[model samples]
Target: MKVVIQRVKEGKVKVNGETVGKIEKGIVVLVGFEKGDIPSFLEKMADKIVNLRIFEDSEGKMNLSLKDIKGELLLVPNFTLAADCKKGRRPSFQSSENPEIAKNMFDKFVEICRKQIPVETGIFGAEMEVYILNDGPVTFILDSRELFQGGLS
Candidate 1:
């Protein structure tokens, strides 16, 4: 599993002219599930994302976590995060999780995030049009494998 976390002032997702999910001030998280995702993997990613201290603090230093700033999250499933584009013009998705597995892990991840802050989400596996107003342009990538191995500090 992998996640790209973007701190945003506002974000929204639309599909076919219908609004699916939106957030006011929070992180826009793009999640990617690789093969071998499991319950433990989902839990680890959830834990890691919520605790990331990418938000700024007093004196304008990046020292506040999502939990500290009381932020929201717009989570989207992005299988392309796993794309391998090292050697070819076309990227390879050999590391992406299958639909069944990915959907399961994605659902679990949403459930966990929703339990914390005001969480918005895009339709899992859907082609979504996302509009984001990035703030501070602060972004971080979380790897489920690394989190699972206790490297999240």
Candidate 2:
């Protein structure tokens, strides 16, 4: 599992010109499932995200968490995060999980996140136009493989 987390003032997802999901004062999470991803990563990642101290506090330090601020969350499925572009001119999605399985995983992830904060989600496998007003342009990437293997601290 891989996730790109962006702190945003607001974010929305539109499908066929119709808004599907929207959020204000929160983070936009672009999540991807790789071939070896398991269900356990969902809960861990959700906890990490909601508790992550990315928002600013009264002292102008990044000391507040989404939970502390009562912020919302926008979750978007993005299999391309698994793209392997190290060799060829074209990016390869060979590591991406099977769509059917990944969709289930995505739904489960959303459920887990929703339990912690107000959550919105882009339709999986749908063509979406995502609009984001990034807050401080702050962003971070989390990969389950690295996270579980002590590669990220």
Top TM-score: which candidate number?
2
In model 1, the Cα lDDT at residue 84 comes to 85
Instruction: Give candidate 1 regions above 4 Å deviation.
Output: 150-152
Pairs with steric clashes in candidate 1:
none
* lDDT accuracy of residue 136 in candidate 2: 94
Candidate 2: tens digits of C-alpha lDDT, residues 9-62: 999999999999999999999999999898878888999999999999999999
The sequence of per-residue lDDT tens digits that candidate 1 reaches over residues 1-153 is 888889999999999889999988889999887777667776667777788778888978888888899988899988999888998799999888898888888888899887877788999878899988999777788777776675445
RMSD of each: 1.4, 1.4
